[model samples]
Target: MSHHDEEIDAAGRADEFLQVFKKGAEFTQDLLKENERLRFRVVQLEETLKEKGHDTVDESPDAIELKKKIEVLEQEKEEILGQIKVVEEENQNFANRYIEIEEENNMLANLYIASYQLHSTLDFKEVLQIILEIVINLIGAEEFGVLLLDEKTNRLEPVASEGLVTSELPSVAVGEGIIGEAVHSGENYFIDSMEGYERDFEKPIVCIPLKIKEHVIGVIAIYKLFTQKDEFTNVDYELFTLLAGHAATAVFSSRMYSDSERKLSTIQGFIDLLTK
Candidate 1:
């Protein structure tokens, strides 16, 4: 080959190598720019997603309503608590009243039992005095009286008495005063705060009928001659009625024994006559 031809071939080869190196450098720069742009877009999308998620959390309606409901329920709970306190106080007062009533009932019942037992004795004077004392104790009175019916005269006689004058109602007929009505009518009478009667106008009076076999035979007079206004309760009635019934039994027994003794004496007299 010629020398000139060799030199031309060398120059052509060097130019081709430079052109290839320049194209590779430009391709590398383009690829770097595209990678930087993709990285920036991804960062922007991540920031947008974070903001959207924050807005959704802040706008939760259920959480806001729950907070409001909690506040309202707390106010209502306070109101109910006040109401419960009032109810508890009222219940305490009612329980106290119930206890008081029960105590009174027990006292009256015990009094009745003691009185009934005492009047079972056969001695007329002792029995009458014991019954009157029991009635006075139950009524809390300073004065009391008992009137017994005499079947022979159909009249009431004062068998027992406390704090009474011999002139004012010493002895009355079976159908005379308010007490007499109770004895004959077989009914009980209760009067409160009366005026202008034979005894104890300033106090309460309980008139009980002593009945045997449903027939009133005697009068039990209980005078609330001194007590506070409306102080004595109706429990006194229950006790008084029980005493009246027991007194009736005692009275009837005494009458029967007396009649039997009289008849036996008469029979003895007749035998004596026959023997003579």
Candidate 2:
């Protein structure tokens, strides 16, 4: 063959070799990029598994440690929740105790006021009126009567009453009905309602004996409690004790004081007339 033709053939072979080399270089670069991307993805998966406290396929010591830490955190969270619940219950109990103390203080204040009012007057009629007022307002009694014992007949005679028909009251002997029994025993009596007593008369729910020393001179009968009160409380019992111990003494002292004052004034007037 001619030399020019041989040279053209060699150049064509060289051009083909260049194209093959370029293609191989591009394939190698693509393989390197793909390897790097796979390496980064593996790192991401390991970090995610460790953070989630999960054992990956490798099951490394770090994963095991992370799982134990997660378990501890879960237990601590439960303990914290339990502690919070306990604190809440304690707070509720404290609040309830505070309210109870406040109520007791108020009850004591009422008792003091009632006692003060009982002793503040000297008029015989006024003393009876004050006793009735205390029973109605402080003790929350709807129907009640103050009965003074007759020395000669030994029977009860009502002096003051509210919400009860005076004519309906029957004559009670010294040891007969609830009021009479309280007066005889020198103790307080209580009933829930009028279940067994006579239906003709209003049945008294409570009877308190008024006493000076050991002698019961009168009785207080409560027919029905106020609607707001369901039953008597400890404070109510305290009030009954106060009345039982002090009511008769207060009434007697006021009567004696008035009678003495009247006698002294009469004596003074007689002395002045004689001097003139």
Compute each candidate's TM-score over C-alphas: 0.57, 0.68
For candidate 1, the clash count comes to 0
- Against the true structure, candidate 2 reaches a TM-score of 0.68
- List the RMSD of every prediction in angstroms: 15.1, 8.3
Residue range 96-136, candidate 1, lDDT tens digits: 99999888778766865765566667666566766766666
Give me the runs in candidate 1 sitting further than 4 Å from their true place.
1-69, 72-90, 93-97, 165-168, 195-206, 222-224, 227-232, 254-276
Q: How far is candidate 1 from the true structure (C-alpha RMSD, Å)?
A: 15.1
Worst 10 residues of 1 by lDDT: 195-204
lDDT of 2 by residue, 8-82 (tens): 999999999999999999999999999999999999999997876644523887777888999999999999999
- The most accurate candidate by TM-score is 2
User: Cα lDDT for residue 38, model 1?
Assistant: 99
Q: Name the runs in model 2 displaced over 4 angstroms.
A: 1-58, 165-171, 195-203, 227-230, 269-276
